[model samples]
Every structure is written in structure tokens, then in C-alpha cells.
Target chain A: MKTFPILLKTELKLSLRGMDMLIFALCMPVVMVLILGAVFGDRPAYDGASHTFLAQSFGAVSAIAICAGGVMGLPLVLSDYRGKKILKRFWVTPTSPAMLIAVQLTIYALYAFASLALVSLTATLLFGMRLAGSPIAFLGAYLLVMVSMFSIGALVGGLARDGKMAGALASILYFPMLVFSGATLPYEVMPPLMQRIADALPLTQGIKLLKAASLGLPAEGVALPIAVMAILALVCGGVALRFFRWE
Target chain B: MEYIVEAQGLRKTYGAVQALRGVSLRVQRGEVVGVLGANGAGKSTLIECILGVRKPDAGEIRLLGMHPERERKRLFAQVGVQFQQSAVQERIRVGELCQMTAALYPQTTPAAPLLAQFGLAGKLRQQVSDLSGGERQKLFIVLALLPMPQLVFLDELTTGLDARARRDVWQCLKQQKAQGLTIVLTSHFMDEVEALCDRVLILRHGQTHFEGTVQQAVAATPHQRLEDAYLWLTDDEREDNA
Candidate 1:
């Protein structure tokens, strides 16, 4: 229990002291929110929905930070540790792999929560958008999506041996989620066939749950998305634990 | 006296290369054993097997009368290890590294005293990246002794150190040995083996060609220097390559 906090502090220090991953994780999503939100501010979607483009886009855009941190950032960090034999050093010590993984999850979760606060506050104060759903429900949905996406990151990062391989796997997971899961491309605008495929994506279910929660929609139809998210969380989490190579 | 480490008929193979083949040896308590081998010899593999990082295909290994592979956590808590080229995390400060290492041991000595003993008290705040090669190696040695472990594994611990720094580490090892700690060290430098190890194991082609004191190993060859004797031992294999 005590080791987790020490490891988390070390990881956070590592992230902040280093420029590359921190810049990408903290600044990239915020930059995207500002740029995309500015260009499409208050414009109606093609379907003439009641919500402004800025509001809808920003709500969906918040999901991008989760995706980037988990799918892109997490895997690379895991793989680099493996390649550099960092985990090997820990293997000879009392530190368990579970402890290491728990630390990583905690650090990323902290970042995810920070990102949410930043994005939501910015959208509300600067863009005149209102949060539509129960705050508790929205918070619950965000945590679930973060867990599901981090599982994917851990699986890719733990299994891959090098940064290049991890990066490639991350791209395969990130691009589809960014484009098809309604973060960058609204699901309503996609072709019907593409929509069906998007429905199968982990992030698609995640975004669906998020949107449904934020819009105050009933939880009845949201059951499928929740189930998918749970499955993704379980399966990826299990595989990552099983196949992780320390060195 | 009871042996601190004992292994028999250890065998391991990686793809086409045979790392250890029927290799066996024993080290008594408080003995400082040096593993001397050519680059391709199974020294590292043997150390890995002893550390329980690599499972042997055919062998019985006992460290302090317990099987290391089956009881890894228990064995690890009592053993200290300094690996090859372990100074890659250069951005971390020496003091922080020491503190982090101390957390893993149930009973750990304070870092300040250890640093002071190593003449590194002034460099505790220096980043690992800024340290000289010898200082970095010394830092690893300090970490290895953080727990005051019963059995310590120093794999090439003095590889890149200068003569003075290498002598400093050897003195520390001698002090530790005098206090009844068992030491198992591996090094390619023949002089290091001569200076520190009480007994040396010469590994060739994944087998122990010689197992005796450094003087005995030296006496076995007609040549004077241990380096010459070592060359003589591996000369046949080099000819086979030619």
C-alpha cells in the first residue's frame, strides 16, 4: 500500500521533469479543444441539432485526452521500461509487478481527473457551455472510460518490446477511436456501415456512455455500452497482466 | 562450515547457443568467490540462475541452504545485486536512488553513512548522468549493500572504475567479508579477481575449466600472470574459431 504512493510520486516526477510525454499528454488535448472549438463555435451540425457545435464538440473532445494518455502515452512508457531493463532492476527487489502497474494506473488516473477539471472549467467559463447531466453520473462515466482505455494502453505497452512497436500498436488503437468514436468525427455524420463498426470499438462504447450521461439520457439503453466497456476493461486488463515481460 | 551456495549439473540452452552445460560449484559461508570467464562463457547465465531470474533446464541450486527459484522473494530479500551497465537512469540523483533502494529492504542502513564511507557524501545530490563512470559504479555498489545483505552478487561491479576507485570498492568488499558476509562477484578483469576474490571459477565454453583460489588458478599455468593463464585457457577455443 505504501509503495504505491512512492512509485506514483516517482512516476509523476518523471513525467513532469521530462518534456516529451508531459507536453503531449497535458498540452495536446487542451490545444485541440481551443483550436477546434474556436473554428466551429456555436455553429449547428448538419442535422440542425439543438446544441451548438462548440458544446457538442468539446464534450466529445474531452474523451481525446483519455485516449491519448492511455492508448498512446501509457504503452510507450511500458515498452520503454522493458527495453531499458528498468523493470529488471525491480525484479530483484521486493517490488511486485502488480505494484508497478498499480502506480502507473494511479498516476494516469490523476492526470485524467486533472484533464477533466481543466477541460470542463475551460468550456464552461470561456465558451458559455453548460454541463447537462448529473455531476455524479458524469464523474462515474468518466472514470469507467478512463479505466477501459488504460487497460488497452497497459496491454499494448506491456506486450510490446520496443518504442517503435508500441507506437505502431498505439496508432492502431488511437486513430480509429479519435476519428470514429465521435471525438473528432461525430458518429451521427458517419455512414451507417461505419457507425456499426464504430459501435464495436471500445472507445465508441465509452463515448456513447459519456454522451448519454452528460445529456441526462436514461440508463436503460446505455446498458450495452456499459457492458462493452466492462468487457474491454476485463479482457485487456487480464491479457496485459499475463503477457507482460519485465525485460 | 556449511556452503553458502551449491549447484550441480546445471544446464541451459538458448536457441543454438549452449549457455551452461553440466556446470557445478560450491561456495562456503564468508567466502569471496570470483567468476572469471571469457565474453561468451556462461558467467552471466550462471548468475541469473542463482538469482532465479532464469530457470535452469537441468540442475539443483541452493543458496544459503534454500532453493532460490522456488523461494525467490525470500532469497531476494537477503541478497544484494549490482548488474552490468545499470547506470542508465542518469537523471535520478544519487541520494534519491539510495532512498528508493532502501525501501525494498525490511531492514536497511541509512544512506548517509554508506555514502560517507564510499567518499560520495558530497555527490548525493548529483544526478546519475553527471557522475563519472567510477562514481556511478560506486553508487551501484552502495545500493547493493543498502540492506547489509548476507550474500551479495557483484556482476562486473568494477568494470569501468579507475585503479583508485576499484581499490576503494575492493576495500569495502574486504570489510564486508570480514564482517562474515558472503560475496559472489564476476569480473573479466584478471587483476580484480587477483585483488578481491579468495577463490575463482574460470568459465570456458559454458563450463568450469578451473575452480580454485586465484593463486591456484595462476599456479595451474606455466605462465606467470593470471591474464596470460586466462588467455591460455581460452586460446584453444580461439583457435577452433580460426
Candidate 2:
């Protein structure tokens, strides 16, 4: 539709002006890569793996941007729009609310990919960190992680009555996922009981899949991760659609 | 008679409180109809139902000879609305907001001329959050008119405006009326109603209590002034209900 591009362009412009989230989502992962790669250069992973620490952790670190944007930034913006009646204004126009939601999702997806590229390129060029996994498999797993994480955001934004509630819910999910899901804290260093707790989190499975693909190892026991991410994407995405409020 | 809007026995309830109780009215084509009401009189609720923003619990409503619920896309394409509490994103620029809105409709008035007409030519690149309230109101008017709609709804369009800014907005509405645009407005200012409305509808306790010209409204009450007449009508309704 003609209106999609117009909405996308305007939305992107507005997003660029408020660069706080953009910086966090796009730059934070690359920053993490630089810091971690420097501090632990060429050191073996604590899991007794042959690859350097950076190579094993790069896939998980790349997912930090998606978690930030999808869980926190997306819901906050959407709920703020609804609270201010921006969506209500659009509801009376020829453009449906679904179109606006689609545009927002596309924008976040672009951020996710851009963050991935920046982190990958920086790690490869600076630290000789290479992804040993199949590129196609890595990409597929990355997309599944994005969809699953973003669906949680859609549910929060769609159901939250105001911005305050959305922010509260997003923070509750965002911080724990960032720390426990091997994004901020390396999974290999955690104790056995901590690993079990981390594994219970939805994002941990995604990290495992990414780690396997990035290490070029056999994607053994991938069925469970795939099923969990798929079910989460379906359930959250379905509920969000069902209860989506335009205003 | 061709009615651009028609509603019969419309009712809405929010929990135990009734917002609209069997309210109904009709607007003929090309008429500037002013809706006046007290704070809790269901003026916004009625407008929302008619615009298909909310569904009425019990009523049949039509806009531009089409059912609002069944033909919402078509109805929205032909109607423009400015709400009392709705806005674009705060960071969007004036020109960008106008362009985005224009892209939604099949036809549009040029954004540049419309912005200039609303005295926003210099504010084209200004962020919406930076504009004063009156300027934001004017920008909303520009957006509402960009669609070149057949019917426009403005709810409390001049609530917070100063006298001069209010008049400027009124001047823009007068020009639109001159171009044969039908407008449905809600306001507390009797002078505004007298200056622009061809007919007036007043609501009390969620029902239509008076429907006529300003002159008829004045003539019906012991007081001849439009403001006094409005007060008398509302007080009369309160007394009757008591």
C-alpha cells in the first residue's frame, strides 16, 4: 500500500530524533562485544570449549539489542501512543491500526539486523572472531528469537491501559532476560542450579540455538528450543492480536 | 431531504452509568451543526458512536448514506475528525504530520497552502511538542482539512484558545463552510455557535433537549441573549428532571 511507505518514513524520522532507544538497541551490543573481546581475548571459554570466549559469547551478545528493542522500547512507544490518543486519531483515518503495528515491527526488525551486522563485523575484524556455524541456520535461529521476543512486546503494549503499566511490565521482563539469558552474564560461568533457572527463561533457549549455530557444531537437541520459541511466538502473537486496543 | 448523518434511539452505557439514553438527531447536507452540552451530557459519546469510533448499545446510525459499522473504511475516507484529546506523535514535524495524513486518503488538499492558511507556514519544521496549545490546535485543523472530507467533526475545537486564536480558527471554519463543507462542532461558547452554525443541537442528561437555530433558541426563552437562553434551557431541564 502507498500509505505504508509514508508511515514508515515518518515513523523512522521520529524514531531517529529520539535516539536514546536507538543507541541502546543498536550500539550496546557492539559495545559489549568490544569490551568482552578486549578483556578476555583468545582465552578458552570456561566450559572447556576449544574456541575463544568471544566466539562462544558473540551469538548471545548479538541478541542483546533485540531484547532491548523488542521487550522495552517497542512496548513503551506503543503504549505511549495509545495513552496520548495518537492511535485513536489514526483509527478514524483510512489507515487501520494493524498497518501502524506492522510498520513498528518492521522498524524494530531492521534495528535487530543492523545490530547483528555491527556486532558481527566488529568481532570478526577486531578479534578474528568468526561464526563457525552455518550462516543460513544462524539467520533462521536469529529470526525466531526476534519474533518470540517481539511478540511479548506486542502483548504488553496491546494490553497495557497506560504507559506506566507498559513500562513496569517491560522492565520486569527485560532486566532479568538481559542478565540471566547469557546476554550480560556468560552462561558457562554460572553454577548448575543457576543454569537450570536460566534455562527456564524463554530467551535462554534462543541463546543455546544461536551458540550452536555460531560454533559450527551439530545443532543437536535443537527440537526443544525450536518448539519453545515457536510456541511462545504463536501464543503471545495470538493473544496480542486478540486483545489489541486501538486507543 | 438528504441527511449526511442520521441516528435513531441510540443508547450507550458504561457499567451502571448511562452515557446516552435514546438520543437521536439528523444533519442535512452542507449544514454547520453546533452541538452544545454540559460536561456529562454525552456530547463526545454521541460523536464517537456516529463516527464509528465506538459502537452504540442500541441504535441504527448512518453517515453519508452508508452504515458506519459495515462500511467503516468508506465512512472514514469521507469524514474527518479532530478529537478533544487526540494528537500526533510529539516528535513529528508539522509538514511530516500533514504529509503522512494526506497519504491515507484517496484525495487531499495540498499541505503547503493549508498550513499557510492556518498560519503555520513558519512552523512547518517545528516539532509538535514544541508548539503552543493554540498552534497545535491549528495544526489539528490543518490535518482534518487535508483529506478534503465531505463531513468534518470538531469536538471542543476552541476550548483552550485565547480570543484572537479562537477567532483565527473560526475564520478558517467559516472559509471551509463557504466552500460547502459540512461541519459538526461541539463548543460551550454561544458566540461561536451563533457566528458559524446554521443550526444548533443542545444535549442535557444524555438526551437532545433543544434543536434549532440560535434565533429560535433565543426566541424560546424569556431571555433574548443566546447565552442566557442556553442557561435557561439547561436549568429548565434540571428542574423538570428534579
Candidate maximizing lDDT: 2
- lDDT by residue (A53-141, candidate 1, tens digit) is 65656556678778878998789878877777777877777665567667777777777777777777777777777766788998899
lDDT of 2 by residue, A128-212 (tens): 9877888998999999999999999999999998999999999999999999999989998899999999999889998888888
Instruction: Kindly report which residue pairs in candidate 1 clash with one another.
Output: none
lDDT of 1 at B178: 88
Question: Tens digit of lDDT per residue, candidate 1, span B83-138?
Answer: 88774442677776777677766678888888888778899778878988777887
Kindly report which residue stretches of model 1 are placed more than 4 angstroms away from their true locations once superposed. A35-50, A184-201, A218-224, B87-90, B161-165, B237-242
Measured by TM-score, the strongest candidate is 2
lDDT by residue for model 2 (B107-179), tens: 8889899888888998888888898878889898888988889999999999988998889889989998999
